[model samples]
Target: MLLLVVSDNCQNTLPVELLSEVEINVDCSNPDSDDLIGYIERTYVVQDAEGNISDPVTQTITLERVTIGAIARPADIIFPFDTISCSSGYATDEFGNPDVSVTGVPTTIQENYDQASAIFDYIDISVPGNLILIGDDESVDVDLGASFPLFDMTFNVISVNTNGFISTASGDAVPDSECPLSLDPNSLANTNGARIYALQDDLSADTTEDALAGVYYEYMTESPILTPSGMLTGVSIFQWKVDHLEASGDYDLDFQALLFDNGEITFQYNEIGTEMGSEATVGIQSFAMDDNTTPLHATTISCNTPNSVNSLSAVGLIPPTMGGIDLYPFPEGVSCNGYSQYNDQIVYTDSCMTKILRTFTIGEWRCNDINERYFNQMIDIMDVEGPTMDQLTDITVSTEPFSCEANVLLPAISPDDDCNKADIVIDIEYEVGSRIENAIGDVIVEMPLGIYTVTYIATDKCGNESRMSFTVTVIDAVAPTAICDADQISVGYDPSFFTAVALDNGSFDDCGPVTLAIARTDDPGYPDLAIFTDELEFGCMDIGNTYEVALLVTDTANNTSICTSNLMIEDGIAPFFADIPEDITIDCTEDIDTYPFDNPTVVDNCDLPDAFTVSLDTIDINLCGESMIERVFTINDSDVSDVQLIQINFVNQLAVTGTIDDSPVEGCDASDAPAQTTVSGLVELDGDLLISDACVELTVTSSDASTGTCP
Candidate 1:
């Protein structure tokens, strides 16, 4: 069904992909007669795989001149068996992805299929002998097909039966080599029930649209009929010539061959396979097979002869027939250079260096034997990204005082090629740009407060360097504690210094936790000395000079802390305690109007009659914070809010040493009178202002007695 129609619009190219079977519907109304040159332009259409009708591919169907090449067997058939076709392979997309491309096809579908099938079909599959072939084992064969391509063949067995014994019965599609050993030509040539099938494609022509693909093929006995009792099977060779290739000159080549000994019978599966394959071969060769072994075996043989008919003729012969190849006008005998082992390491050499040939151990393999032969030239190079990088975990950070965190993935360590010339070594950088500061150790650094940059750098096994950079910003912490309230003296006031004390009640920690620190701003390095007494109020001092002190408080983590306070000193007069009236009786006061505090009073000294009187009065108090009983009394003239000075000096009356000149600082200056002119009930010297000079022992300003030192 092959119809090759060339258009004036298209040049040398042929429709390779267009070659396929297309079912046709006959218009029975037309006369059932063959019209050679009839002109009837009725709109005849052709339907595609999707059932879309297209204008019929107008072509005159007729017999194509056929030619047979001096070749044999399977899978594909070339157009001009001896001439290479210059064409590009066809490729189609599947699901938007590229799939495998259909390589160039060799037309002249004769023994090509036989060859391909022989190699793949017999893989693990038993060739059926046509008749009671109710069931045939195709699993091993099909599975093998998954790893290779299978072929279709028509075998003619003459010597073996289903019982695995020699038989006189014949079967279609049988291999003569499957007979008993006494029938194999190699070890013992087989010559029984010689069969000859009709040359399929020659007698019949394409009846459909496809290239009239060969389905029911055959393999009969060839010339020089072999007999079982004949001499040892002569050497058979396979020679291939690649010319006018569409793209390049030379190429990689490989092939597979199978044989059987059916001189006795070829119908069953009781036989074991004879030999396995070496598989890969890269070369141009002259010979194809060997002999003298069961189940048959062969290896490619090289030739000392050239590729021309002139050279072959000079050697006393034209291309001789080996295996199934007709070297024709080329060299005679050739060989497959040698076999390579599986673990055999190969140093890929440049084509410019060694253009020699090579071969595999076995005879057939689809991937290996792309063509029906073997050669050594450039075809295509292998591809790959090759081993790369992996993963990472656990990151942390800190400063004894300040710190942060950083993390990232580990870079890959492998060579793309093998030159040992990569970039930087294993080093990770911080990102201050994208907010990633450099990782210190196992931490992924967060953005820092200020502006900065970070980048990870790495090198390949080949020393190829690569780096990635990023930005980061580290944040700032809260401000330390400060002195909002200053320390001062309690002068002429109630608890002026007590109110002046800096308390830790204020916010200390700005972020995590707050704390307060109270310290003498004058002497901050020391701790607080204020005693927590009933009179001192948490270590509060009197209104005189006091040493510098403070209280420091910190946060929970004890990382942030501060202190602030100033200790101001002023003149301190001891607390005044009135002396008990000298056995004085206070008149009972039944009414507030009778005992008036303004008219009567209790004093410290009795000698001073004005300061020695006694009086008392009381009022009532209420529950609502009101004083029910207001006890009242009268004291000598003095500012109640002023700092009380201690008039009791060392001698129980006056100053022991230094004198005051009314200057700001005590004991710094001396005037005409160093001791005070008046003194009242002090700590140990309870009486009113002592005017008698005999009462003091120490002198004023110098502690040396001088007459009338006490005023």
Candidate 2:
């Protein structure tokens, strides 16, 4: 609606209608784009040291405002009461004569111009002048039409109702000449009742072309055929229904139909001789048809059997009140959806039977007829007593007057905000009168998995009581299962352990969470004990160690469900520098060779062993107190006997504290004198080995053939 580019330094103002969006492209390399730099530096009216509330600088030439408008028309008329009264839906109060000088005048003008038009106004802080709206350089001045004219031209008033729709004639207490009516139509100032009508072209319904006279209901009489003989009136509707359709295979359609003047009629179900049932429908048709055909728009109601028109797909629950199933939820848009108040009329049954009456008032707008009515059918389901923790509740039901599935029982725990709470137990003593024909199995029924009835009586000194019963049943079911994609993943951390997590397929039995137990089979320490309250948590496993992840899932009936695997660990990681001998001091400066050193042991805990690959050796060069000697030795790989590093720290057998080469290398025998025994092939090591003032060379070699030392 407005272009809101505001700046703190510039005067604040807004054009109610945006004209254009201006954008300056900075090449970042061009000097002509200096305005782009200033644009970024300029502070806006909504910008502060804290934050920016204004829209980001969104400037482009293509952005512009489009104009839209709505129009209104004014009118004046005269009434036949000698004074005109405004009757448009907007004019709530009547206005009398404004000027006393025209006291005899009967005409009046009624126009609500405020809401019938559009407006745009704002206060400007930039300049002391009226704002100008520029549309493509064409400035539209707001002051040009500061005040709007009441009407464009003079017009005559005339009524056009109760006749034809085609018209161009106009008038004021007279019709327009363009539309030549045989005579003048009725108007507010005219002698008859007539008003202009707006044609509804979008609607498809047929409306009365002319004014309707009247409507009445009547009855016919053949004997006394005269002027309005019966004066037909009070067209009434009839309705009825049955108590137990499966008992006598009949409908007890006892109805209470209200008619004209709050009158009523009760239609008793007289179909006691009718056996209305078939293989398809448990119940058959009734008085739905009149004169061999059903009334207009009348629907049929029947007790659904298998494969019938009103087929019962989901009837009462199978293990009715046997399994621990919760209550049913209310349908959408119903007043009972979350109705937590005790004053509410509805009650959910133990067998999950939602006992409710979807009642409604059918009106003329909905029925569209004089004698119209609506009927509500009763469906056979589990008794709507209340909720129960367990299906078979042991209670004392009397036998005074017994009605099958009468929704009679003890109180439930509660359906208060806490959904997890179970039902409550109470003293349920009842008197029931039985129907011999409706007796299912026996007075002492043996129910497999559902809530059953056991009739009995407990009368001491008081009078005899009616038939009573107790509900009993059996239980215990299978649990659920879990599945993972892979049997086992190797612990070599591609950093992926959760990706291989086992999933609960939730293949629960009819017992549901009861028969199920969840746990982590990988670690025996973590076990899921609770039914629905259990969850398996698996900790992270790394690459070095092999792991055995597992799960122990079972049902309430103690069914063992398990899945496990053994994973292998990975090898080959980056090798760190284990050890290198610290200070090796050479006493004399000779050839300065023989760089023989051993490495410290490289240990790791990665489940698997690590092998070392020696790289190029490092050597430090010395250039002090030198006789200017250049020493180097070419030792071949073939000359090296041991590939493994040797830990040689001691110098001699006597602990004489010499060097490592001083150890026994040449062979000595008792047959020969120890004093005469000599060392041979004593050579120096290679490389620039020196310790400042000391440097020596020695290369020790061993052979079976010995010779004397020549140092």
Candidate 3:
């Protein structure tokens, strides 16, 4: 169930009533004129069948109006009522007249000038300045002492025109064309380089009065006007104090153009006579006159209108009319022509020459829920500072001795700015003939041998940029490197195999291709008797001999280097007996002197067999009946030797034969019995007798003949 309590004042003890649905309507009207016409607060609470009650919620009701007769009146407005009849006690509602109030709010104007257009200060250079020109439609060249940037180009000299403009072209003396300049780049009025027209018109300068009617200028090392970024120090002021070329009307104009070091320009007018800028051109033209096809982009503040200031002020307020509130118009007679001594200034905000004006209305007044009046607001912003960097010098280096490129140490560069220094960006660009192989901070590798141009461009957050350039000259000065094998190189005794290329380990030139040459060097007291030719030729005598060799390496730049190495002509194969005879054994008795044995034929890899010497010797060993002989044959090729052996034997044969006669003696016990027998034979060798005398004697074994007689 829902419970609601209603009260004119919020009180917890008010009587509670049950609500049928979730929504409720409240009556907020005063019944009588003396009743309070305010808010009536109501408190609500909900409870369930379980005796649980929710937190109380309160709501306010407003009684802002009172109804009388058929009209409803605002509750805050009260009117006195009179009773028409005392018995009925009824009165008629009275209505009040419509009234309005208005108030004026000052109009506010704001401007945000970019880096190129924030210069607004003006300096009078007409007096105490150099009067360079004093004639009609005349121009002169003047030195600016320091570089001034304009249209992305820097200039140290300017051409001053008596018609109220300056040109950055070198030696420019041509006056601009007639007034009301066209936007065409090929027009005679739009000359070369950048042009700043403070006031361009048909004007003439009197020659006698140097100070009163001539083109005057002064270059200041320090600027008179304080800049917002404080980075623009140098200033060049060119002022024109001349009379317009008119027949009888007063057409005197005084204006000056200020050029800042940061490429910002400002035009200020001090006094404008009756002519004003009726036929004058006041603006800045970018550098595009060189090409006829390119359109001239200019910041034309005014073509032929009167010069004016960028300011806003409120005129008298216009009261609300029957239909709508009238808006106030701009103030009249607020230009240089209306005011004789007008001090008007025009600022170029960016390279595109954009002019921003911000207006705001504040503090509004309302009548019958309608806005009646408000104040206006204006804000101006300025930021025009370019980045700066240290100067860079040219670099010169040589390529590596063994390489075609050099590892150059690049200098580090950092750019700084007065504003937005951390947001500055640096871009590096190479010239047409320059290239980079590899890069790291402080070290760059593989730069070829040539001159290179490098440019550094630094830009800050405001699009203001600064640039610098330097040259890098890489030269070829170091000699080539000649390397030879550490160990001796062995080759066959041939000139083709023992060359400079074969003996070279790794020889090279860093910058280009290299040529190699080989020559044999002479060493005193060497063991070999070999002669060498200029082409490194050696005879067979040079085999198994080593000689010193020199390797020369030369580069395209004529740089040469020499290294020494040992060259050996090796003869590793030994001579062998080509037709050697097999070993044979023979008897010593045979004619060994006529054995028909000779030295064996010899063959060698690098030596002829005719250059070899052979020798033979016999060795014998005697036995009881035979003798053995060894015939050793040796062959020498001077560097190596070979040997072969044959064996021979001689056998000795001799025999002796004899016969004996038997004899017996009587007596077995006879110790001395005499029995003798004699025999003779011949001793012979190989069937030839050498001796013929022989003798033999025999003794009885058992005395058998004497024993039988005794029994």
Alpha-carbon local distance difference test for all models: 0.26, 0.25, 0.53
- List the candidate 2 regions with Cα displacement exceeding 4 Å: 1-476, 483-552, 560-566, 571-580, 583-594, 605-610, 617-711
Which parts of model 1 are misplaced by more than 4 Å? 1-338, 341-485, 489-513, 518-547, 553-557, 560-564, 568-711
Model 3 regions lying over 4 Å from their true place: 1-343, 347-396, 400-453, 460-462, 466-477, 486-497, 506-515, 521-535, 541-547, 554-559, 566-573, 584-587, 591-594, 605-630, 637-711
Please provide, for model 3 over 481-578, each residue's C-alpha lDDT reduced to its tens digit, 9 standing for 90 to 100.
89998444433444334556776788887777887776766744222223222245655677667788877777887777788877776664556667
Clashes of each: 128, 55, 13
Candidates 2 and 3 compared by lDDT, better number: 3
Per-residue accuracy of model 1 over 107-163 as CA lDDT, tens digit each: 111121111100111111112311221111100000011111111122322222211
Indicate which candidate wins on lDDT. 3
Task: Find the candidate with the highest TM-score and give its number.
Answer: 3
Q: 2 or 3, which is superior by TM-score?
A: 3
lDDT of 2 by residue, 1-711 (tens): 235555554435432223344344323343223323222122223444444345444333321211111011111222211012112212221232212122211111111111111111111111332212111111111111111111111112221211111111222122212221112122123222111211101111111211111111121122111111122233222111222223332222111111111111111122212222222111101111111211211011222222222111111100011111111121222221121100112334232232322221211211111211222222222221222222335743322111122233333222211111233222232333332222222233212333445443322111222234456333333333544323433332334443223333333433334232333344445544432223332222354455554444554545455554454444333323344434343333322345554444443323224334344333333333222222212122222111222222222212112343323344453223222123332232323221121232333333333456534
TM-score of 1: 0.24
